[model samples]
Target: MKAALVNRKMGLFLALAGILALAVAWWVEHVLHIMPCELCLVERWPWRILILIGVVDILLPGAAGGPVLWLAVPVLLTSIGLAACHVGVEWQWWPSPLPGCHAPHISGHTMAERLASMPLLPSKPCDAPTYLIPDLPISMSMMGGLYAAGILVAFCVWKYRVAHTARRIFY
Candidate 1:
């Protein structure tokens, strides 16, 4: 029972994390007027899935929900991987996997014509790194990688303790 309660709490934490990340992204886009690159947009999908999973875990019974929060472990690790790839792109370590990472040069088109063709809010190229904190060497992607890794480790440690306690109590 304690394990289940802890798991549910962790689920809520993961959900809040997802929401908070998304909220930051939204603020960056809408208020700050910063555009997210293709890879940046791709990185958000897992968080959306995590949010759904977290909510479900919070609502469901212990038998069904205990295992659900565990999914966040891999989901967060994969997010770390995605952010790492973005960092690599920013560093020019390798070519971007997504072609949309580079903006195509359009020429010979009239100004009005180009405006009609372009997206309302242009996506920032993946090669261009956005630094949320000024004067800090850390890019947003690097920060995301660190954040995910930290959360992953913390979640795993918390899970281990809960499992250890449950095992001792039950057996």
Candidate 2:
């Protein structure tokens, strides 16, 4: 009974956190007028998936919430990976796998055709890092990676405690 309550609370926390992360990203892009690179856009997907999982975890029966919450671990891991890749691109460690991260190659010979081939909105290059804070050296991707890692650690600790309690009860 207590486990279920804890799980529900955890789920709620995760869902809210994910929503906040997305909202901040949107605010940065729309309100702050900061353009996100293709890789930055790609990094948002895992959080969306995590939010869905979190919603499910909240809706499920208390006993069922634990396993559903477990699903977020892998999703968070994926988020961390995406953030790392984006950070790598920002660091110029390697080229971005996303084609949109690169400049569009207009092959059309005619001026009209070239204009049509051009992207509707100019894309920010992946290598360019956007610092959220004035003096902070950390980029958005690095912050995301850190946040994901922190959540992952918390989940692991929760799982360990659950296992420890179960062992005490069974043995």
The C-alpha TM-scores of every prediction are 0.88, 0.91
Predictions in order: lDDT: 0.84, 0.88
In the predicted model 2, the residue pairs found to clash are none
Runs in model 1 lying further than 4 Å from the true structure:
105-121
RMSD list, candidates in order = 2.4, 1.7
Query: For each candidate, how many residue pairs have backbone atoms clashing (under 3 Å)?
Result: 0, 0
> Tens digits of per-residue lDDT for model 1 on 30-89?
999888999999998878977987898889839878878878878998999999999999
TM-score, structure 2 vs. true: 0.91
Estimate candidate 2's alpha-carbon lDDT, on a 0 to 1 scale: 0.88
